[model samples]
Target chain A: MYFLAIGLIYLAVGGDPAGIVALLMASGLGGLIAGFAWHFGRRYGTRVEDLQDSDAPDATGVVGVYPTASLRPIALAFGTTLLVLGVPIGSWMSMIGAAIVASQVLLLVHDTDD
Target chain B: MTTIDRKPSAPTVTLGGDDPNHLVSIDSVIGPSGQEGTGLPTTLVGWLTTTNHKALGVAYFVASLTFLAIGGGLAGIIRAELTSPGQQVVSEQVYNQVFTIHGSVMVFLFAVPFGFGLANYIMPLQIGAPDLAFPRLNAFSFWLYVIGGAVMLFGFAADGGAAPFGWFAYPPLSGASGSPGLGADMWIVAIILTGTSGTLTAVNVIATITMLRTPGMTLFRMPILTWNLLVTAFMVLVVFPVLSGALLMLLADRQFGTKFYVPTDGGSPILWQHLFWFFGHPEVYIVALPFFGVVTEIFPVFARRPVFGYKGLIFATLTIGALSTSVWAHHMFVTGEVVVTFFALTSSLIAIPTGVKVFNWMGSMYGGAITFEAPMKFAIGFLVTFVVGGVTGVMLASPTLDFQLSDSFFVVAHFHYVMGGTVVIALFAGIYFWWPKVTGRMLSERLATWHFWLLMIGFNMTFFFMHLLGREGMPRRVPDYEPISNWELWNQLATAGYVILLISMVPFLIAVVKSLRGPANAGADPWNAYSLEWATTSPPVEHNFEWIPPIRSERPVFDFRWINHDDVGAPGVAEAWMAREGLDDRWLPLAGPVAADVADDANAASSADSDVG
Candidate 1:
């Protein structure tokens, strides 16, 4: 909302198209955050953080399940390095990087299913 | 000579219900025994794949420090070249590349990432969260940073020998006609990747601060460091994307014959400035705020008082973040195109919140028992130098003044005072303060004293003279200068100061090396601190805390310690109880003799209440 208002103001003040586009993009990001917050608030209801009379222990006991370990980050990083390097190097490197990235994404989804 | 055990003390209280799945008993969470089934492997592969925030935080520190060494080495070369006059060290082209790479490495790789590193390690502990909201994404961000930084350095090995167009890479200067090289292209690609990493990390930080704060640690109740990081993350999320976009456009202009910055071809070079500074200005606050948070945390701890006007500090931080977005055009004041008055106004407004913070830090120390530990010493150095920097910043904010001083050594001095003097000094303070909690060992105080004094003297000597040099019309980013007036003298002094600065790091490195090789003498609550991090072991367990004390105040650990031991009427009794409980004597009021006074005041208050009844 802040970005939206700023964008509108910039547009009113004869700002450049690029500047306006940047402002609008920021507004879109703001909207995404708002949406995320709305979804989370609805799903989780009132958290202990929101309560006035809550103790520290009230919010304890496994906040959420997190991964113990995974090789995907390093693998994905290797793929990204290649993908970015391909821009300066060649198209073949990009192809190989894209394949690895695709595989990592599939594996991530498959792991989530388990 | 007492070796502080890293093992957690047994749980003394229990809470929540008896349901096995939902059990929140203190015993359930507090010890290595409880973590038997959930231990992360202690192997190289484990480190590569680990999504633990603490481990990733350590990685950030190591990578950032490595980059700092590289950047500092580049700075040494630049200073060495400029020490005398005409191109004494490197060619003009090599000089440009050297300074550009130095600026890029320092800002992007070292300063920003160091803050994130501190935040990653400490913020979760401060907020009582086990890890960041997105643990996997956190690891991914770290790896991306590593790759991006590696690629950035790899630019020097490229065909054209790195980007010579400066860190900002403004306009036609950065175009194919200006810097037609694979190095520039690599620089762009590296920045885009790192910017993406920063954006993703910002999202992770924001989500963690917002959602993962433990019960009673409300947004306002959070420690100032976490609050600063939360605001810093928001700024990062908004601005880093702009930088990434700008870099992408620059790449397009360079490679694809785009006219984005080609003014003759219906494009404006000023557009790039608009986008860059929009990110760049906030980027200043993004780096500085976390360090400011570090000092804010330090002042209260060393002064042995709660942060004065804590809520006001929060509002001040928020105000700074909000105003920072509007003040980006102040960097372009000399361009003669921006609304100089409005930009100037927004930029000046930042000083108010910053002043509030400075005063609040003073207020925190006023009329309080204070200690002169290395962290506090460095923090005091930060206060003095940062004020000087802040005043200069306000002076620079004025369009009339900026028109004269823009691109001069004055600008260099002002930012270095803030970034190098303030941020880096505060970073040292934080490192000294938290070394125990991070490593489960104590850094040498004797060495810390030498490090602090050398840094303070060296930093001031280096940058303070640049103000006069700049005022005398010496422009920055120059490889060599004419010996007109006192330019040569000031340059020589600055170079000399840089040597002192270089020497200062020696003691700090030794301290770190010695501490790591030494025993774990810094027991939990080494400084008898206020925050949650100190409530746990020196180096916390795999899951951070075994048991979090009830968060009745921002100073949860302080409240827990004093309140639990309130039954002891005197210092002797307190000592007896500590000894009976096998507590290290070092934990007994390392802040000062003030703890005994506080205990007396508490006893008096309780007895007076009984008399009234």
Candidate 2:
């Protein structure tokens, strides 16, 4: 927001299109702040700063632990990297990336019950 | 809940025992009824997928060290190229890429990531949190950093190797026209990814610090390092978005044909400068603030004094962070695009807050029981070297001097003094200070002292003369300079200094390796330090702590010692108060030699434990 205002000030006084990056940054961070603020505020409320109100110093105590040891994230990383690189690399790589991503998402959401 | 045995006399801080200063009740958080945390899995897969903050911290530490080695190797190449005069090493093109990659790696991979790793390991522990607010996100952030690093380095395997336009990768030069190489594009994508990783981590860190502190640990009571990192996270939140936003536009112009920087397209290259430096100036502080935090913590412990002006230091840190954003244009003094007056003024304003921190540190050691331990030795070195950096920095803040020295080795020397000198030195200090706690072992002080002297002498030898060389008008980023330029002797001396730096690092490395292989006997609170992290086991449990002593002051361990022993602190305070109040010290125990006495006792305990073993 500070950078945004500066860029606009610089441009209004003939500094030229510093506005492009500034506007992009403002939007990116604005959205992030809004999302994060809402989530953090709703979730923690005023309890965030009250260290005394927190649970005991139990290392093993936790609120939640999701399922673990899956290959989905690895596949996701691979596919995402490949897809990004494919933009300047080749269309064939992009196809492979797209395919891998689709399959990985399928495998990811599949329940472990079976 | 394990019981850490203190000296037979010093009251033991046990898990279930009733400690008078116990801040939080065990029944509320650590009693028998609380369920065991989803403890770490035994398998490598579990280690890989685990959200344990400590594991992630270690992963970061190891990865960042590897990156430093790689970056250091690149620096070696650049040094080789500039050894005496002629380009004795690689060609000019490779030279460009080498230096660029060196800067990019050092900035993105080495300093910042290393800080993150240390903070990740220590912050949650210091704040007495079970884990970061979002653990899965923490793991994800770590992996993203790893992948980002991998992608950046992977650019070397490409046809053109890596980007030659430098880390900032300025427009026109970095665009499709100036250097048409896939390496540059790869640099763009890699930087974007790295930036993304940092941003995500910043979000996690900010949320963790703000929302996850244990009860009783108020903002004022947070450890200096946590406070420093908290400020750093906010700076990251504000500044990195600018870098990412700028890089994205630069990327479009490079790969997708949007002229955000092409002059013909009404896009000034200066736009890149503005955006980059806006992020870049605050970015160095993002790197340095952790150094400040570490030194701040180390000085107080080694000096046996409360940090002078705790609130003053916090306000100074916030001031520096705010002022850091305004001074970006100081870097642009030569560019002629910025309001020189505004930048110069803001740039000079930074010194006021920075001076407050410096005075606070010096004052912290004054009138206190100061010990020159390995960590303290390094911190003192930071003060000496960083002062030179800071003073020279104020000189550069003047646009007149900047015009003369902007592209010279002078700026190089300044940053190396401040950035490499302070950040790296403070990092060594942090590593030494925390090693006992982190690894459940202590580094060899004998080897550590060797590392320190070699580094100090060599670092000063290398950079101190660069100021001279810069004053003589030696240019930076050059593969070679003519002998007629009268720079040969100074350049050789500078080159020798780099050699010394490399040599000094050997003992440092040896010390680390030796400790990892040595005994795991560093009991918790080896330094008997004050932070909440020290209240736990040396290598803290799977989560962090089993039970924390109540937070009475910023220095919890120190306060606990005072409450329990009364020999080291309370009597001393009482004596001062009595003298000030014109009363007798009749009721108080003798004001014993504080740190030395405790240190002797701790040493005796350590020796006895060894004898038993």
Candidate 3:
């Protein structure tokens, strides 16, 4: 919402298109957050957080299912490093990076299903 | 309030019990731990793939400290060269690379990540959350940072050395025609990766804080540090991507024949400033606020008082974050294209909130039982030096003054005062305060005292003279300077201060090594601090806390201890207080032996008091 306001103000002031784009990008991020909040608020309505008089222990217990460990993040990082490095180096390197990224992403999705 | 006077029926949970070492695993209480799996084995591979926030935080600390050493070495070279005027230490080209890499490495690799690292380790603990909302994403962000930083440093060994156009990398200097080297491209790639890493981390922080806070840990009940971090993450989310975008445009101009910053080819060089400073100005607060949070946390613990005007501090932080975005044009005033008055107004307005924070810290410490531990010492150093920096910052906000001091050592002096003087100094305070908590060993007080005094003297001596040098029209970013009246003396003094500053790290290093070599004697709650982090053991176990006390206020741990009358050695007092406060029914079956011992102690204490009367 703040980002949206800033973007509108910049537009009103006849700011640069590039500057406006940046502000709009920020607004998009803000919207994403708002959307997430709305979705979660509806899904898990009136949590202890919403109740002012709630006790701390009421919020305790398993918060969420957190990943204990995963190797896909490392693979993803490696692929990204290679992909970015290829930008300055060569197209062949980029091709290999893209291949690794595609394979690892597939494996990640499969892992989630299992 | 919903009347809880009627004892609500619920299963009782005992806190610390008779066994003394009875660890209360939340997993045990809340059913299956959900930890059993054929996931990555607990080995080197497990560490590599670790999504644990604490482990990743340690990695951040180690990596950032290494970069700090590298950056400090480059600074040593720059100071040594400028010690006697003419370029006696290295060639002008080397000098340029030195300062450029120094600035880039310090700002990008060291300062920003250091804050994130602290946040990673401590923020979750403070908020009573078990872990960040997206642990896998957090691990990915850490790896990205590590890889990105390594790639950036790899530029030093490139054919044409590293990018020498300064940290901001303003074009046409950073353009293909100007740099024409792979080093510049590598720097851009590295920044893009790190910027992405920062943005993702910001998302994770925001998500964790918003969604994962322990029940009863309402937003307002949160510690000041958490509030500051929330604001900092918001700023990072907004600005870092903008920086990434600008960098990408610069890369395109170099590689894809785009003219985003090519002034000769229908591009505006000033556009780069607008884009960069738009991110750059808030980037200052991005680094500073965490440390500001650090000192705010420290002041209260040592002074033994709640933060003065806690809500006011939060409001001030929000105000500063909002105003920082608008004041970026102040940096571009000399370009003769900006609305100087508007920027000047916004820039000066920022000082009011910052001033409110200073008063809050002072008010926190005004009449409390203040202790000048190593943390307090460095925090005091932060207070005195940050005021100087703040005053100079306000002075520079004026367009007329900024025009005069533009590109001068005064500008250099001003930022260093804020960044190095406040941020770095407060970082030391945090290191000292939290070292025991992190390492489970106490740093030697004697060594810490030496470290504090040496650094304080050296830092002030070094940057203070630069202000005078700037006033006398000594330009910054130059390899050599003509030996004018007192210019030589100022340079000599500054260099001498640098040497002292360099030497001061010795004791700190020694203290770290010595403490680590010793036993883990620093118990949990070493200073009896108020925050939730101190509630757990020093170097908390895998799941953090065994049991968190009821958080009725921001200082839950303090309240717990107060109810127990732990200072009076009265154990049963906690039960009595809980019963009186109508909390007994909620958490009964109070540790039997411990309760008995407490009851005995309370009786003994009462009798002793009566006898004295």
Top-lDDT structure, candidate number: 1
- What lDDT tens digits, residue by residue, belong to model 2 across residues B452-525? 99988888877888888889988888887888555877777777888998999989889889999999777777
Better of 1 and 2 by TM-score: 1
Q: Which candidate is the best by TM-score?
A: 1
lDDT of 2 by residue, A1-114 (tens): 545565455555554355345544554665677687788778767652454332222111222233444555556556766666676677688788788878876776682522
Listed per model, the TM-scores of chain A against the true chain A are 0.78, 0.64, 0.71
| Candidate 2 residue pairs in clash (backbone atoms < 3 Å) | A51-B214, A51-B215, A51-B216, A52-B215, A52-B216, A53-B215, A56-B29, A60-B37, B22-B550, B23-B550
- Residue B221 of model 1 has an lDDT of 73
> By the TM-score metric, which is better: model 1 or model 3?
1
Candidate 1 residue pairs in backbone clash: none
Evaluated on chain B only, what are the TM-scores of all the candidate structures, in order? 0.88, 0.87, 0.87
lDDT of 1 at B110: 92
Candidate 1 lDDT, B447-502, residue by residue in tens: 99999999999999999999999999999999988989999999999999999999
- Tens digits of per-residue lDDT, candidate 3, B241-284, equal 77888898998898889999998889988888988988999999
Is candidate 1 or 2 superior in lDDT? 1
Better of 2 and 3 by lDDT: 3
TM-score, predicted candidate 3 vs. hidden true structure: 0.87
TM-score of the second chain in candidate 2: 0.87
